[model samples]
Target: MASRWMWASQTIILLGAVFVLAGCEEQTNSAQETESAAVVSTPSVLASAGPVKTAEPQTPSMEQLVERYKGLELIDAHNHDASDSRYQSQLGLWKQTGLGRTVLFGDVSEPSAVGTDAVAWEAYLKYPDRVIPYFSGFDLHDPGCLQVIRGNLEKGYFGLGEIAVASTNSPVVSKVAWKANDPMDGYLPQIYDLIAEYNAPILIHLDPVGGEPLAKLEQALEEHPDTIFIFGHINAYNSPQETERLMAKHPNLYGDFFAGFTLYNPDGGGKAEPFLPVLKKYADRFMLSTDSGYGITEVRAIEAMYRVLDQLGDPVVQKNIAHDNLMKLLQAQPATQTQLKELRKQGAGGAGTEAAPQKLSKLEAGRLLAQAPKG
Candidate 1:
């Protein structure tokens, strides 16, 4: 009996040992499987998903783009001189950017009298080479104004006013209070007469407040088919329709995009979209000017204009706005032939005749004259 009981106890102990060994092996295998799965899965996940991406670089702003073209030659079609100090400061800025020449329109608001012409002449004499003066008309209502216009023309003034004509009202009849009036009647004929006589262009400041000015413009176009006019301050056009209609109708009419930066958002908050097709359609007629009055320096104003052009897309358009169109207009002028000769002579030690001379084109002489300046 004792031997049988001992045998039973030994069997039970062996069974317990076997069970313990099996449990240990199962745990080892499970742990090994979990580690291997982690390694395999990690590599597959890493392979499928690459590293994170970073942002791209940025482009330069409009102002910076303009600064790049500093020291380039530019012609300002419209400018004014109110004071000597202001004039010098403006001219200095112009020199920095290679301002070739500026067309100065005298203060038209000068009370209509001999004093106005004298003041205009004095301003011209102050900066002869730097400025091409435009004589102001006497009151369109006064016959004597025509005589003053002719006298200034004889003196070599390029064209007519920074003329303030209200398209809404006739400044001629309503001389005292020329509020905006549509169907501009009183002054259109007289102005047209002077424009025709001189065969010179007139700069008109049309009212932007109402469509009245545009209506007056249309009437004027019908009356004077041959009249050449430049709409000063493109901001006055107000709406796209007026701009398109007038630009399409008048070959001789042009737009000056000066002060346009301000008028762009009269309400003070909106995008100033490019006059797109308007600029593209009449790129030839359109010209850029600072219209930077007495306060702003010429260089700063010119830089501002260039900044606007830089945002205009591509260098070609920028070059056209900066130089080409103005060059074309300058070349078209009858004075170019004589001007070139004088420039050549000035280049040489020879005296550049101050007065405007008659047409003299001797190719050989001109060529020699050109060389003398360089030598």
Candidate 2:
């Protein structure tokens, strides 16, 4: 009986050991399967994925900028296309770029080229609404220049300009040297007096760097407060503080803020930010321009002008600087009819002369000139 009981116990114990070993083997196989699955899945997922991406900021486009600025009713207060060949193209540019008006003048750099005044007249005649014509052809030194100016003003020229009185540094700009012994020297007072009588603006390019030029400018401003002097490029190198002081001192002394000179001049060595305070402070006393001289394209220069509007940021101020300020001067009293009749009788028909100068259209002349090789 004892032997039978012991055999039963041994069989039960062997059965229990077999069950435990089978369970261990199944767990080990499950773990191996899991390990194999991870090894295959990890690389497959990584291989399917590409380089990680990150979000980046964007800048406003030129088109977007144009759209924003198009509503400002901009006036180009100082612009020159001395060669009449580009009048049509200029009109188109002004239209496309949203320029409401332009103060147009001829090149005064060369003696012979001064007849470009005819070009200015032609443009004014063709698009009088768009152009505010200014006579700049006569020599400033000529004592007879006052009469010539009177003759043109009598014939209905808007103002005088781009009269480079102190341009001496730049070789390209100083092609024909023009310096004032001082701003008030020579026949300037007479010219100023005539301009005052006509109640028109005279755009002067006086580089008042030294004490004398500025002092003389102040003297002129004090002497003829009625003569509206639109200082071109705001005397290019003058500081904002100086500009503010001058503006405060002389209400008749306005500024032509040449955007290209401020923003694109390689030698300017400054940014637009510095001038903002003075610009905003004297918003009504300032007007924006695209001098169009700095080897910059018209479109680019116009863009710079718009940029000044954006920087100014106040709609009313922008409107004043862009259009109304200059318009006020433009809409002011012009030469009297009495003055006109006498001047006309003196053969001072000016732009209204019988034989208007001949001119080639841009498509005909400009393209060929552009295609000609550079010197």
lDDT by residue for model 1 over 1-375, one digit each (tens)?
010000011110101111111111222343234333433332111111111112123433323434466434556777754322234334434543445666665444235423434544544454444455565546655566566666665444566756666632323323323222443544556767665654567766655425666667777777787777777755433555567777898776877766324322223112234464566666677777766431233333454465455556656666676666655543333433444455555654233323433332222223333344233
lDDT of 2: 0.62
Superposed model 1: Cα runs more than 4 Å off: 1-67, 70-72, 83-85, 112-129, 167-184, 259-272, 293-300, 314-316, 335-375
- TM-score of each predicted structure versus truth: 0.62, 0.71
Q: Candidate 1 — worst ten consecutive residues by lDDT sum?
A: 1-10
Error of 2 at 302 (Å): 0.6
Q: Residue 321 error for model 1, in Å?
A: 3.0
Candidate 2, poorest ten consecutive residues by summed lDDT: 1-10
Candidate 2 lDDT, 22-97, residue by residue in tens: 1112223432343334333321111111111211234233345556777767888877764554544455456645
Compute the lDDT of residue 28 as modeled in candidate 1.
Answer: 39
What candidate 2 gets wrong by more than 4 Å, as runs, is: 1-59, 172-179, 338-375
